[model samples]
Target chain A: MPPVLQIIDLKDSQATRSYLTKQTLRSWLLTTDHKRVGLLYLYTIIVFFAVAASAAAVMRLNLLTPRGDLVQAETYNKLFTMHGVLMVWFFLIPSIPSVLGNFLLPLMLGARDLAFPKLNLLSWYIFVFGGGIALYALLIGGVDTGWTFYTPYSSTYSNSHVALMAAGVFVAGFSSILTGLNFIVTTHKLRAPGLTWFRLRLFVWSLYATSVILVLATPVLAMTLTLMALERIWKVGVFDPALGGDPLLFQHLFWFYSHPAVYIMILPGMGVVSELIAAFSRKRVFGYTFVAFSSLAIALLGFLVWGHHMFVSSQSVFAGVIFSFLSFLVAIPSAIKVFNWTATLYRGSISLDTPMLYAIGFIGLFTIGGMTGLFLATLAVDVHVHDTYFVIAHFHYIMVGGMVMAFMGGLHFWWPKISGRMYPELLGKMTAIVTFLGFNLTFFPQFILGYLGMPRRYHAYPEQFQVYNVLSTAGASILGLGYVLPLCYLIWSCCYGKPAGNNPWGAKGFEWETTSPPPSENFEKPPVQTEEAYAYPVPSSEPITE
Target chain B: MNARAILYEQFSDLEQQRESSLAGIWAFIASEIMFFGGLFLAFTVYRLNYTQAFNEASQHLNLVLATLNTAVLLTSALTMALAAASNKMGWKYSTLLLLMVTTLLGALFLAIKGIEYIEDWHKGLFPGSAFAWTGSDPGHVQLFFVLYFLMTGFHALHLMIGMGLILVMLLLTWKGWINSRHFMPLDVTSIYWHFVDLVWIFLFPLLYLLGAKI
Candidate 1:
């Protein structure tokens, strides 16, 4: 046999003693293991992603013609509401953090498990219970309040399952809180002996930033949802303008949690892209401290810019300008990240691996997303595009194009470690390309249509806009294909793919020090980090700017 | 040696375990602050908009009972602090006694709050359709009452959770699961108890005292 197959056989023999060795269902369901919890989250979120994507498919089909003949207008409202709610709370928000963060944090720290392993298990249970409640609301006539659940309509007017959906989201917010709390405590307390602050991976830093937002911001959302639900039930509660309460107060409170929520969704993806870029390029990340601090900057600055979303809601012009300016400030840290990633790739032994494809795609797409965000942040421009598809396209570029691409990249990058198997690389690269092409084809034209006076959430449009609608729906089909291909191949790889030895990609993180599908205890003995992160052996002329 | 038995498997030593638990609870409390902070913010906005009506509604609250309840909560905090201190000093029976006193004080505060709710109901101060307020601005007064009930009700909910946790600590102490050497549970619980008390400290002034200056 060749040397590679011999090594594969050696690694394959160890799989019997790994975390996957347990075949009993009870072990998985009641596991306090962070890796198992992460896998549980991975399975749960994938199901939610499929459900939300199906909702998007129906909506896209409905929008294929100038006149929406596929679903009724009310159904379309419900469709988008379900899509937005699931995609935001169920899928995107928890995608990277709960799954990858839960799996990797302990491994990277070389700890036995998360600080509170039982709490980690509880977070997953809360997530699933909350997901069940949200689905139940959908079954009993879905809510149409948009995921925003903007007031007056959600509180008084809309006659759908508003309170039930709010309750679902309210319960789910605790999961995010617990996960954030667990991560913060673990990062503070559980690092291996020599793993000081700067020596940690950028992913850990970004997650720490993300957790700070998650811990502080999610509770406000929980309370806001509770108040909204109470208002819907009481009819005389807060946010009812007729009752001398202000609807704008609801908007302020909701966005206070939500704008930070956007960071929660994408920051982990940025962390993931950071790791992928460094690992695949085989170089130290350029300006490590700057990149680490930029994550913190984005989290801190994310809070002050919530009011930008309120600029057109009769908010004071002075406040709008401040919010608009603060909104512009967020782009600086984001640009720092993009520039540093690009700089890391320069003069490095760059490999066009599957993960690198997604990372590069993220840099290009996130730049587009970040730049368009400034247009919306401008006070004068927002007046025209507020609540339009321009707003829709901008966020999708961030959430879908940016976050989702980074998620796929991280998943592929970490797949061998996660599943102890290698997915077919050609198919992985093809999915990345198709997803990038499909995402832009779907959303890019919507920006044009929005600028040309097409509003969002409308089932029917003017005949002049039908061509773009057609193009978007076509892109939706391709995007759906991109998502489905991974589900099939990744699952197939789990059972049939060739056994991948430890450190298949020659990655340098502490996680790569252990076996793929690491033992239930994570490491046989605790690891002490000695080298700085992404310290590629090839000497770079770049000075280590601490 | 007994404390060693209580250490979780994930931590390297007892000190790291205690440190993590403290950090974890503090993080939890920070989130709780934002939770209550949202309601406080809404109250601030509406109070500014309808100052007179909110003041009028605030005046109707039974200040005497609420003041009494405030004293009850403060005493509970003192006892809670003593309990934590006693646990650290390894005085098993005294710690249990102080914990019981703290839990009772919490119950007394809740009972007084229940009486105040009944009094408010008799005065038709509730926010629903039956709210019998003919004040300067009935709508705004109703809004004021809506916020008052929500804030105080949520605060009461948190106190109940704290009380339940205290009961668990009491049992653990009785079972000798929490001793001086392994007092992190009691320590963490006291922090939570004090946080609840502090929230009430803010609420008493915001809801009950805002109208006192007038």
Candidate 2:
């Protein structure tokens, strides 16, 4: 047998013993284990998925017959806003890094727990508390402020439970800040012996970059929201246009945090796709340091591009020009990542597994999504596309199409360890296929509809838009089935699926070197660093980096 | 024979774990700087935008109380830092005493802040309904006060939270949960306390010292 297989067999035998014990499960749930805390975050975000998806369902329902047939146009507006708010803050931004990054970061680096376990758990609770409040706010009528929570409308004009929903978003913002702080502190202080700066995983580097955005970007968001809430309650003139305040200032402040927030959403997806691509291709990622720094580069450049979102919204033309040029520059690092992933696949033994399929879906959709964004970035193009379904189609491609695809890829990639059993592979592939087809069906035609000058947030569109609406609504149904199928079987797999042997997929990482389900401690003894990340077939000599 | 011996022997890694937490808290304090740094960046940008409005709005603030609040917060930071340092120097009582003083001063800042707010309310300087600014283009001037209330209001909220935490530290110290040898509490508390001070260091210039005539 091969040397790597020998090691794999050894871990499988060990996992068999641990699986029979009750202590591991109890230790995971009640204890202050950072790994366990990460798992808890994973569990909570699925609930976010269920809630956010329902909001999307309502959005699709409203558009089915058009002309305000199914739900009132006002109901339609509320539906989309709720969908945007729940998904962006709750699911996409926090999903990969907070849940998976928190789970895998310390373990991959061989730390015992995070530098602060209590703080780790506290961040999770804060996240759940935030989600609960937002859910409740939605239950009691709804907040009419778009997820962006724009000024004058959010502050003074439209009163649809503004305080409750704003408060919910406020709490959620703190959770993002706290989690980012914990990850930064952990990466700084908690690496295992000899896990030097250069020797770290690309995923860890991406996570560190992400946390910086979270800590810095999220607080500004929190303060911005607080100012809005106060203006709503205290009737402050800070952003009230009638009171001589520039409501545009609120737009400037909001997109300041929000534009970087998209990076916060997508950077982790970028990180997850890195692991997925490398693992599936069975090769060391090309230009490793460049790929790592590119994550940091995207994060840095992301902050400079917020004004592009406001180009047609009365921002100074000089600011618009700066933001426009920077927007083009930001795409360079993202292109570098795509180039490296493609290079990793060159002359490699790539497989078509469930995770890899989703990874491929992420790449294709993310590219199309990214390309469409350039149209919105250009001054002339933006004038034509602004506030149109072209805008909606453009972002949903990146967010729902791109980020959500990577999110599922990650869920399946890490599930064997997270749950102590194997998910049915055939069933997994079906969902993956459905998700891809359904996603494309739903959003692709909307791009054309948008370019044809159909405005978004309209309950009754011109008869010309009906064809596109029919396509979108039809796609949503398949997408809904794609989403629901996994929830059923993945849960069923938890109790009765085949036992996942340790290292079910032949991979070379310390996480794979552990049990199928890790022990309560995650490692029996402190894992010593011995190999560089993503070096396939287990190199016998000359470990890369430090 | 003593609690120290038992703490070390029983857990076997208690001291190691506590030191890790102390390290963690200091790292968290660093993150806090960067977090507040973002707001400071925003303030810097807008301060550049409407300099006259910013200065005129600062004038509406009572400088006496602002100066007094600055002194009080600075003194509290000093006490809090000394509290952490004294624990390292093996002075448990001094550490506890400094913490107590820090708590007292934090409360004093809130008290002075409340009084200033009341004075502003009477002067019709609040941002919203019943705002008064004697100038041409009073609207942008009102924006300055809106920002003033927001920036200072946020700082005040952080102060209140810090006060609550310090109270918890006081009770722990009194309960003998804190000591010279096991002083992670003192260290973490000091980092937070100093952060509150640093916030004021920026707030002092931005809110009170900027655009002052005398």
Candidate 3:
């Protein structure tokens, strides 16, 4: 046998004694083990993703015709609301952080587990409980207040399950806060010996930045939702303009958290892409400090740009100009990340693996999403496309295109380590191609629709926009297929795929130092980091062998 | 080996574990500050926008009861601190006693707060459309009462959670699970208790004292 297969067999035997194979279902449920908790988050988030994607499917089908044909106008409203709520809170926000972050942080940092392991378990329970309540609300008659829950309609007019949904979100916000707190403390206090701040991987840096946003911004969301719930339940005028409450006050409080929330969704993806770029390109990341600091810069600058979302909400032009300027400034850090990743790949031994494909896709799509954002930030352009499909297209590009692509890339890249098996490479690459193509086909036309003066959130539309709607629907089906492929193949790989030894991709990180599906305590002993992260070889066609 | 020396299989030593636990609590407190910070920001904006109405509405609060509740919470913080200090000193009996005192004081604050809520309800200070505030700008005044009830209600919920945590600590102390070196549960709980107290300190001044001189 070859040396790699010999190593694979040796590690495979050890992996059978992993946290997963040794535990019963009851033990798994009650586990304080970070790996088990990470799996728990993974399974739960997939369920939420299915629900949200189904909602998206229905919305796409409904939009297929110029006249609304599939669902009633009210049902369509609830459909989009459910899609927004489930996707934003249940899926995207926690996607990489809870699942990959929980699993990898300790492994990457060489810690045994997170700082507060029990708190880690509790955060999962809190998330499930909150998601349960929200799901229950959806079953009982859904909330139609658009996930934004903008005032007067949410507080006074709408007679749906606004309070229940808000309560669910309010409770879920705590889960985010606790998770953030755990990550922050672990990153600060639990690094292995000799693992100084600058020696950390960029993924760890991005997790740290994401955690800062999670810790600080999520609480504001909790408070804002609490007030919204109170207003809905008590018939108070906190947001009702007719009752002398300022509607703008609600907008200010909501966006203050929501804008930072976009970063909470994408920062982890950026971190994942950094890992993918370094490993596949077989080079140390170019301008490591710039990329690391850009994560922090994004987190800090994210807070100031919330005003950009409120540009047309009766906000002063002066405030709009300031917000527009800050919004443009926030894009610089994101641009820095894109540039750094490209520079890292320049003339390097680049491998077009599945994960690298996704990373490259993320760069292109995020650039487009981010640049269109500048258009929205421009005072006059925003006035034109304020509530149009352009806004819808812009966010989907960032969220679905940028973040989701990176999420898939990270998941595929880390799957061997996570599940102790190598997924089929050809299948993985095919799915990546399908996802990118389908995602673009689905959203790219919305830009044209918006530019042609088609507004969003309407159940019915004029006949002129039918071609774009049809194309978007067609793309949705393909995207849906693309997403389903991984769900099926990944599960199959988990059970039957070839065993993946440690460091299948020959990544130069501490996490790759351990066996695939590392034991419950992670490393057999504490690992002391002695080298800079991503210390890949210069122009090596093959990964270095021990 | 001592039962408490399990070290949780994660940390290298007891000291590292204890420090990590303390850091976790402090990080949680930092999040709590932002949680309450949002409400405070809203209050500041509304207060500036509707100064006279807020002050006039604030005057309707039962000052004596709120002030008494403030003292109760402050006393609870003291007892909580004493409990943690005693645990660190290996004084088991004194730790238990201080913990009980802290829990009782927290409960006392809640009791007073409940009475004040009932009084406000009777005085028609609720924020419904038919609220009976016969003052200038009833709408903005209603806004004040809305904020008052919301902030205080959330604070009470937090106190209840704190009380529950104290009860857990009490049980653990009685069972001998927590002692001098194993006092992390109590220590972290005390940090949380003090956070509850700190939130009240701000709420007292913002909600009760804003209208005093006006």
Best by TM-score: 1
- Candidate number that wins on DockQ, 1 or 2: 1
Q: Candidates 1 and 3: which is better by DockQ?
A: 1
User: What do the candidate models score in CA lDDT, each in turn?
Assistant: 0.93, 0.79, 0.90
Model 1 per-residue lDDT tens digits across residues B1-214: 3643388889999999999999999999999999999999999998998888888888998888988999999999999999999988888899999999999999999999999999899899987877897657888998888889999999999999999999999999988999988899899999999999999999999999989654
lDDT per residue for candidate 2 within B13-45, as digits (tens), equals 665557556656665665566556645655666
Model 2 C-alpha lDDT per residue in residues A1-546, reported as the tens digit of each score: 236644665546544544234556666556576666776887788887787788778777777665758787677778878888888888888888888887788777776666666677777778888888888888888876679888888899886877778888888887887788778877876677667787788888888888888877787777677778878898766667786556777787788789988988888888889888988888888888889989999999988888998888888888888888899888788889888998888766888889898999999999999989888889888989999999999899998888888888888888887776778888888899999999999999999999999998877877767888889989999999988888888899887878776677776677887776776566667776766778786323554567
Give me the displacement of residue B24 in model 1, in angstroms: 0.5
Q: What is the TM-score, restricted to chain A, for candidate 3?
A: 0.97
* Clash pairs, model 1 backbone: none
Candidate 3 clash pair list = none
Error at A271, model 1, angstroms: 0.2
lDDT of 1: 0.93
Q: Write the per-residue lDDT of candidate 1 for residues A1-546, one digit (tens) a residue.
A: 235644566665565668888978999999999999999999999999989999999999999888899999999999999999999999998999999999999998889999999999999999999999999999999999899999999999999999999988998999999999999999999999999999999999999999999999999999999888898898786998887889999999999999999999999999999999999889989999999999999999999999999988989999999999999999999999999999998888889989999999999999999999999999999999988999999999999999999999999999999999999999999999999999999999999999998999999999999999999999989988999999999999998877787799998987897777888888878898888888789855788688
